[model samples]
Target: RPAKKELIRSGIVRTAGRILSSAASTPAAAEKTMALLEKLSTCTEGRAAIGEDGECVREMVRRLMKCSGAATAHGISALWSVCCLARDAGAQAAAEEANGLTKVLLVMQSDCSEYTRRMCVELVKILRVKSTTSNLSPYHSRTTHITPY
Candidate 1:
């Protein structure tokens, strides 16, 4: 955990945002970056640092299903840290604006650990409520019937 603090002290979270946004970032590189991000997100300062950068949040959202299982797990965990754990509404909005909810749903349907799937579900709840379209949480009464507007 000390290493996470050291990395945060070195401003690696900001650098990480740039790396994730770079086109040169490969899947492996993204995975490693997400891993580091998840580690840093364990603390309050780290979550604030990450949540401050909309691009970082956006990139994490973009990485949802764009890499390996490790990468996906790291990405979701980091997002959960900033969005749910920290309860940063701005980060939640940034995520939704980046189409994070859709990617998270896709990830949940894929092969992933139950922990990650649960995190994705929580992220979905936050992102949906924070969406620009509505500020209320989604409720489904198990009705599968679709109604045309």
Candidate 2:
């Protein structure tokens, strides 16, 4: 069981890294990458695989800033899955350090697809909850102040 899980994780992370590295040059490729991300979001091991790769998390966060439509939605969904399933402090810290929460807020306010908007909102809520409950704040503070426009 453990070996199979490791194999699956390794393959998914490698594929995600390849797609993310090359998908920036083409919209169709980006869309396909997002589709793969969304599919990966459906499973716990997949989410852990993505979270374990710092580069992958960073790339998805970057996509949140640059990509749109389905790609954007999938990126947000993937991050949400990581936040919920991985439950890893490093993953949450990476997202927070990358200003992912702020980007999600901006995306929520933009004229994105309904699915995108929904995922952004959900991601924000998840981050906020994690921050408050886990004391993940830099100051060990208890409150998370996210102002939405």
User: Number of clashing residue pairs in every model?
Assistant: 0, 0
Predicted structure with the largest lDDT when compared to the true one: 1
Q: Candidate 2 residues 1-149, lDDT tens each?
A: 46536655568666776677674457667667777876776777777777777777766776675765677777877787787556656667677666777778878887787866776766776666545333333444445596787
**Alpha-carbon lDDT, every model:** 0.87, 0.69
Return the clash pairs for model 1, or none.
Answer: none
What is the per-residue lDDT of model 1 for residues 26-137, given as tens digits with 9 covering 90 to 100?
A: 9999999999899889898899988888888998888778889999999999999999999997888889889887888888899999999999888887787667554334
Worst window of 10 by summed lDDT in candidate 2:
132-141
Off by over 4 Å in 2: 1-10, 22-24, 113-115, 126-149
**Cα RMSD, each candidate:** 3.8, 5.8
